[model samples]
Target: MSEALQILQKYWKHDRFRPLQQEIIDSVLSGQDTFALMPTGGGKSICFQIPAMVNKGICLVISPLIALMKDQVANLQKRDIKAIALTGGIKSNEMIDLLDNCQFGNYKFLYLSPERLQSDWILDRIKNLPINLIAIDEAHCVSQWGHDFRPAYLKISGLKDHFPNVPFLALTATATPKAKEEIITELGLHNPKLFQKSFARKNIAYMVFETDDKLFRIEQILKKNPQSSIIYVRNRKSCLEISTQLRYLGFKATFYHGGLSSKEKDKNMLLWMQDEVQVIVATNAFGMGIDKSNVKTVIHIQLPENLENYYQEAGRSGRNGDKAFAVLLTNPSDIAQTENQFINILPDKAFLNSIYIKLCNYFQIAYGEGINEQFSFNLNAFCLKYKFPVLKTYNAMQFLDRQGVITLSQEFSEKITLQFIIPSKEVIRYTSLNPHDEEILLAILRTYPGIYEMQTAFNLPLIAKKSNHPETQIYAVLQKLKEKGIIDYHSRNNDSTLIFNEIREDERTINRVAKYLENQNTLKKEQFKSVLKYIKEDKVCKSKLILNYFGEKTTEDCGICSYCITKKNKKTNTIPLSKEILLIITNEELNSREIQNRINNKSDDVIFAIQQLLENEKIILKPNNKYILKL
Candidate 1:
């Protein structure tokens, strides 16, 4: 216990542990398999880190995201703690060097992706290391029932063969009852001590408002809170539009979305984190690995596809225990819109089968081959070539990825590989004859050391800079050389990469997973139904509804939610709806929709209040369609 505490303070500078963190750590230290379900900001990393730090040998950490693994490794390195992550796209010699470092560098942590476990050579090297503990981050990925299911995570249990005596720790921020059971069974945890913190964030008042104008309601919420806030939309266009509108409305605002470059994301994120921007409008891509404790509000202008995602994103606020708000804004149109966006576009089983066969043929995979083969993919081009619906086909691909038929990465990048197929002396003779290509060939040879011996990844811009030519001309020269068989060259501007983990059985492969694919489509429909039910059942407490969804039954209603407040106000005969409308139009006039937008309550309630005011002669409707106080 003392050692754990000392390590925590030394590396993390934390005086004590959060709730359930220490208990989970103690179980791990006692050589017990441990599973923990904590919230997003609950410090799940420290649970594995402290116990692993207390142990003698290295702790092997398995996670899903390459970016997150690199982020953690960098953070550990900053604190002078020894850690390394075997992330993707490394050369063979680099992999060997990294593995050798893990063997003899006294590194306390070794992080890797679950897909990396499929390689026998890497696993063999890992088996030789003196690993004391195995920690799986985002452990929910192992279960099919989990929201972000990854089939590769199912392979993690195979590690038990290499380290029979070592304990394992599995950590996740969100999981359902079925997911929890499957995660335990899938990981083969031996009588694991389970710890689950309550999903309810008492300080966060979950509220939903059906309004006609979402933008105006955003203004009202921000004006009331007037602190750091996040508004989550569903698309890049909305991100830019909303952020622009907010800035026009006199707020320090920024935007983030998937389309933004890495530099843009970092700059915008820094602005918000440093309080230079008080609000950021973004899509779902902005919040991962963010732990801004004092975020006063998280507003979802679009309906969340599922409660699991909703709960995780909404829980980002009020991490410091101050009062906060989780606001979901929806109109009647949003229900059908959400359904069309998420549910209707889901691919059926037949579509899935067709898509699978097309993908195999597209990649030119032979029957019973192509295991672990990867290709730079362009989704739009593939869909166009096959005459498939882009959204439905993309959804089908996601299903295949989760089912482990293929691993998909949607990172927009350009890949260019080159190697000299002919002898270097022959290439030199040709370059001397063609004076225009001589400088480019010399630049490639000088800048890239071993292109002749290996298929080297190179940048066209760098070669152009070295040769003092335009990038297009450099590419043209390379293409001409490839035409003459001087080099083997390949380049692509790709939207994604597809890596197959199975042989190309075509129909047989699709038949194997067909039932599960249908079941997944059914499951998605049920999830969307649950989300709609949550939205319509406004009479129930928001917090209690969320708790019940996760199978956590709580009898008490959280008094901060919209239902509770409305109930309390009904008993007092003063719903504040009329009061707010009157106050806003007292000095300046606003129409019915504008009044409803100004007040973050039910439009029905707002309309009823406006009617009562009209009947009482307290307010008058002008012929111009505006409401005004009758002085």
Candidate 2:
């Protein structure tokens, strides 16, 4: 057996690789820079992972999502693999220790976000490590044309200069031809071998419904498909509203959003993943790196910002190759809302400048200063102080990030850590004096072995369950313990981290990337138009439209999509519409409008038959817009 295959089976417990995965792995193993375009759930991680294991030195993975990095690291550790993720908000000493571990501690995989590349200290440290390969996940973000563009991705190419011999692997689930070319050019890949899996998903039946009553339609769909499902909304308010309504209707449902605490998010996600909940209504924040294979349905309550986003979200269904449904519920108003939300309200250059200036003021940084400085940013406080809209301010910050002016790390869940300040024996004596807090403290000590040595994540729910106490009581006990100098605790539920990429500047900085901003706006307009076209288009198969948008040409229609199904139903109605119209006209010399009103068929079918009759001289149209049978 091949070394890659052996490692895959041993660690991942898979006998064979998915389509195109082994080939990609071979390219990496052969020391060739490779670009891989795999769909969601295509096992993209294994392509780089198996080869990294087969090779000698450590693999450096540059990813965009901290949650994804943490999850993958946890999973790898569970399989007895040494993996570590260096994300934002870590202390300087902790980061030094992590880097030291990566260099000396036989760690096989080291995952870090692209934004970290801005730190010269980090780069200097990385240059000393025995790095074998560099893998970039969500590689499309390096391209200007990609949906999720990040400026830090551009800095990834510098690694090539640092480690000239190490091969590079770029992987993403959504990328167009334009984005693909830009990724290669931006990353400076040398003679890269490219592997692209077909984007067609045969098991997913794409359905779009234009209904006046969306709630009723959703209910109908949920009733029909009573399996694990995900319903995506546009905002947090809707997430709560829909989940509440579903529960009221006696369906097992939960809600998730970025506003939820990490503990709540994990608990809710665990419930759904364990089959304790039938549905999860959430915003787009819910399903990144989620590995649920049995999700039978994925429904979108509104049109997404772009086809790439929609495709990725819809592709979440049917991952196990079982028959599943991807349904989109929208109306005329939704199309308008999509345009307004994504395009019309987009931050202009002036607004972007205002936001940037306000951000500097909020952080109390003067002009031409604050380079490489990081701050714990409170987004709500900033918005409230400046009286700016939250969403628009956030978008402006993202634009600044794309221009390399700043790095925004919005980690929804912070990692809370606690360390015992007093000796274990002293803690035992103190807890004995305060008998009410004894159970919780003992639970914490029993659950986490190194709590006295180093700070660990604070899991209130787990501690509460173990101590047979409510979460409120557990929190009270922890607070009391902290007040008495028994332990030191830091909570990660609030605040985002921001790093100034360069010296603070005024509006001229915006001018430096003016052309890039213009291109982004143009891309946004085109993406909105494409989404609108997908919704209004009735002559083409829905699946075909999506495939074409992704640069895939298909002459054969997915015969099961909503469009094809509607057309098939029209053809199989078993009654000839022309004859039906003629029969109605024979009884009375009626106008075309009257004839249509008298028929029991669809209005479009009736109008089509009338036009055919008029063309064939079977019926005559009078000047008063009336139709009569010719004798």
Candidate 3:
């Protein structure tokens, strides 16, 4: 048994390995750059983790998502493995301490977001550590051609020079052959071992429903399945509204989106995880590291921007090796909405330039002024004040973030309400005459967390939500407490965005780059339509069609697909065309339908004959489905 197999057995308690896992692990163990294109549930993590565990040094993992990093670190720790996360939430002093521990501690894994690569301290100190492998999760992000390209990913290839001997391992759940090639080139892999798994998942049944009434369809889907499922919408408002509707339908539903307060998000997530909630209506923000094993269904209320995202998101269900359903519900009008979204997106170069200029102005710095300054920004307000479209501004900021010009941290922020914990000093002396008012002050302190940490004004809604006391009563108590000077009570709320670390302005405007980017966006719109074509196509086996997309040749259609299902229902008794049967025909060549007419069978029966004859090179097929016998 190999070290990886042994580790898998010892840690994961699995007696046998799955199909492609061992091959992938062997490639990694050989100390070569490895690209593993396993399907979503194909144990992509263990391939790297086992090698990391048995290897001589720490495996540095660069992930695009903060939540995914945190989840992986937590899971590793649960397995008695030492791991650390270099993320934004940590204070500078805390980061220093964590880095020190990573350098000296027995930590086997250190997960950092790609954006963190620009940190001077991280870059300066990493060369000193005994790093054996650099695992790039979501490796497709390195390619502009990929659906989810990140500018930060392009910078990661630079690490090869700093650690010349460290092997690079890039892993992703979905990638086309083009994406695969780009990942390899961008990572600077020298003759890397590529492990490409079949994109087929037998247990998942793909069904698409065209519907004009989305809410009715959702309600109907829920009424039928009622199992734990995820309802994915395109935006934040939909998440809240759909979840609320599910609740009204008397279903236990919760919602998740980037817009929610951190506390509410966490609480709601916990509720769903513990099965306190049976359904979660959410935006794409919901399911990166969600490890629920038995999600019986995953329904997409809206079409994703691309197939890669849809595959990854839908693949989240039926992980327990149980049969599950993945459905896409779309109305014809959605095409207009999607088209509008694509057209409204900012040109990448233009957006980046705007960000550079705005950051320069906001920080009171000259064009080249920003070097290492890090400051929080309100993206919406900034865009509004600058008269820029918010959606375009947000995408630009994201592009800038990917370009290493900024770091956008997805954080959980909450609104908090506080009632005065105590009366004013002058009133406290007077209130000391009566204990009832003093009890109110004590109750106020008990109600709110971290209220004294800041002196910012708070909102009344927050107080109403938190105090379990009426808003009017809380306000009265706050006024009395203010009068007595016992404590300051107020409401506070916070929103988060990516903070850029760039020169306030750039002398070199990349307008040419923006034009090129605009062209690419136009190309992506066409590509997105291709994805739609693939999903809506009902004539080919799902697996074979996907395989064909990646340049795989498999003549055998998967007997279990939407195409196969339709064929089966036709119940045409198809017979294979043997050489003996073909020789009986008088003509040297024949159209397949004409041949079928001679055979006195349905056109469906002719398909098998056509496929077999073509495969055997006994005949040539013309563009119009006519066939000619080989000499």
Number of the top candidate by TM-score?
A: 1
Q: List the candidate 1 regions with Cα displacement exceeding 4 Å.
A: 412-494, 572-593, 596-631
The residue-level lDDT of candidate 2 at 520 comes to 80
Question: Which model scores highest in lDDT?
Answer: 1
TM-score (C-alpha, index-matched) for candidate 1: 0.80
Positional deviation of residue 445's Cα in model 3 after best superposition, in angstroms: 34
lDDT of each: 0.85, 0.84, 0.71
| Model 1 lDDT at residue 149 | 76
Query: What are the candidates' C-alpha RMSDs?
Result: 12.1, 13.6, 15.0
**Cα miss at 422, model 1 (Å)?**
51
Better of 1 and 2 by TM-score: 1
Taking the tens digit of each residue's C-alpha lDDT, what string does model 2 give over 117-137?
877899999999989889999
TM-score of each: 0.80, 0.78, 0.74
Error in Å for residue 209 of model 2: 0.6
Comparing candidate 2 with candidate 3, which one achieves the higher TM-score? 2
Ranking by TM-score: 1, 2, 3
In model 3, the Cα lDDT at residue 8 comes to: 84
